[model samples]
Target: MTGHQKTAFVTGASTGFGAAIARRFAADGARVVAAARRIDKLAALAEEFGPTVLPLQLDVRDRAAVAAAVDGLPAEFADVDVLVNNAGLAKGLSPAQQADLDDWDQMVDTNCKGLVYCARALLPGMVARGRGHVINLGSIAANYPYPGGNVYGATKAFVRQFSLNLRADLHGTGVRVTCVEPGLAGGTEFSVVRFQGDQDKADAVYSGVQPLTADDVAESVHWAAAQPAHVNINIIELTPVAQSFAPLRVHRDTD
Candidate 1:
């Protein structure tokens, strides 16, 4: 509003969808506040984008830090026009019965709680300004459950519902909420982190079929944000062409 340049606050911007979204906004002449746990990667973004990108080292899991960061934004970057909640992850593929408690906790903290923390901090400003967009990163697992996807899928389900509810709450406020759910994506640290840095296993997950790239996801975000004031894109669900629904499994008695 000050200089007519939109400002976007992006979380988990050190890599993957976050970084790509930051890059897209910066290239489009928007000021971007890129926040993540990895300062080094964020620094690279700032260096590449120059003054258009402000790198902030932040862990969304820390509510205090998230609040402080939003409250302390500099004059030029304070009026955030877009908030991208893309900092989420899958911890492990273990069945619920054998899943690690730590993994479940981490997933819950980062995927669900961390997301809400950022939203709660920023939505007030957006509502007051009467103009803003909140784009959340969700997953297809939320709709289609599979083996070893117990907690991770559940967390994404929360995202789906949360986005819809925000729409209801922010009705007539001139604010927009969108949830982008991606399936079988590649070219990111998502699988690696989920597999606990097992490169071989991560590679295997995407070995055969071509999957969605970070750029693809970024483009979806950009499109949703670029819509006219009266337009609201509620949800965008995308998957590789090679992927589709499968038949339900049935177990026959062998005795």
Candidate 2:
């Protein structure tokens, strides 16, 4: 889909969708700069892909660090034609009143503020060059709220709106923005993290059901970025065939 090669930067590239997307981009002849907090994992990915991938350790939640990483990009991977804002996480799944405040803060920091920092740092170059793609990872929770998805869902909604606003702001700049929202994705540490390392609990989230995989999400990102220069895919929402909207909850009282 990429013609004549391009430089792509993917955050949270240590595993899951981010890593998959980075690999796919490299296979398609794009130079990839993979960023994640896990240097070992990122190094493994870089080694696996040989010279096409450049691994850089980063935590998206750190604004100064994120800026430093981008500013320090090696010459070969300096011109990032595509930026995948994929470094996000979900915390405790308790109801709002019972939810952990730390969890809520973490979600907001990483998903909303972290995204803004990356976009702020990279957008000037994209807009000035008049060519770029920023693909933000969102969630189905942004579209349909579920109990326990409180802060996580809210953060994704911020991402969705942010993408739309970016489009308006970049009207004639030839820079593109998109929000990819996925539901019921498996083969990732998302649930494990959310459940605080309870493997069994994490496993149950996708048990007895077929769900989307990281590769599926990666493919969607690749497809959107692969579109013609004149084409812009605003938002793409995806879910596994086995998943659908749930009926609204209602409480009954007997006299």
Which candidate leads the pack in lDDT? 1
How well is each residue in 1-255 modelled by candidate 1, as lDDT tens digits? 234689999999999999999999888889999999998988888989898899999999999999999999999999999999999999899999999999999999999999999999999999999999999999999999999999999999999999999999999999999999999999999999999999999999998899999999999998999888899999999999988999999999999
**Model 2 segments beyond 4 Å from truth?**
1-3
Which window of 10 residues has the lowest lDDT sum in candidate 2? 1-10
- Residues 20-138, candidate 2, lDDT per residue (tens digit)? 99998988889999999998998777777898899898889999998998899888888889999999999999999999999999999999998999999899988888899999999
Candidate 2, residue 202: lDDT: 95
The residue pairs found clashing in candidate 2 are none
> Candidate 1, which segments miss by more than 4 Å at Cα?
1-3
Q: lDDT (0-100) at residue 106 of candidate 2?
A: 94
Q: RMSD in angstroms, all models?
A: 1.4, 1.0
Query: Candidate 2, 27: how far from true, in Å?
Result: 1.2
